[model samples]
Target: MEFWLRVTRSQITKEIRAGRTDTWAAFALVVRLFREAMRKRAAGDERLWGDLLRYAQDVVDRTPGA
Candidate 1:
């Protein structure tokens, strides 16, 4: 759990830095992250999975043409 959290944080930081100048790029990064997290959760890790899933849904709901 600690390792996953650390990896997620690092990936988010990198995504943010990479997409700083592009909103669409940021959204794409988040969608990709969400997918990866979902896959991980489905594999075994249940901790905080619901929260992450909800967040991903919210992002999709709010995004235009999603």
Candidate 2:
């Protein structure tokens, strides 16, 4: 989980630094990634899913003008 969070943060930061300011696009990307992770997990682990959601939310919240 820590590793995934770090990777997600890095990706988001890179996108923002590249001037990809479309919040909706970023949101969609996060959602897609979340779904992919969920599929890979597929173990009925709510805690993991919740943590991932929280991390994604944190990124979105920290985004400028998001």
Candidate 3:
């Protein structure tokens, strides 16, 4: 868990450094992170991940220029 948290923080730092600060960028980051965790079997349940991604997608859809 700690290692995953560290990896997530590192990924976020890299994205921020790359100027990915918009809503779509955030959503993309979440998706990439989720996929990585899922591939490693560390993202918990599929239902929870689905809900999270769906909620994020909804937010992005509602955001202007996302």
Candidate 2 C-alpha lDDT tens digits along 1-66: 899668777877888889886844877886797787787579766776778878868999899774
TM-score of each: 0.40, 0.37, 0.36
**Model 1 spans > 4 angstroms off:** 1-21, 53-66
Query: Which candidate's TM-score is highest?
Result: 1
lDDT of the candidates, in the order given = 0.74, 0.77, 0.73
Model 1 Cα lDDT, one tens digit per residue, 31-51: 687787778788997655788
**Candidate 3 lDDT by residue in tens digits, 1-66:** 999678777877877779886745776787797776576556455675676678878998899883
- The lDDT ranking, best first, is 2, 1, 3
Q: Tell how far residue 52 is off in model 3, in angstroms.
A: 6.2
Give the top-scoring candidate (lDDT).
2
Provide the clash count, candidate 2: 0
Residue 58: error of model 3 in Å? 19
Better of 1 and 3 by TM-score: 1
What's every prediction's RMSD, in angstroms? 10.5, 10.7, 9.9
The local lDDT score (0 to 100) that residue 62 gets in candidate 1 is 96
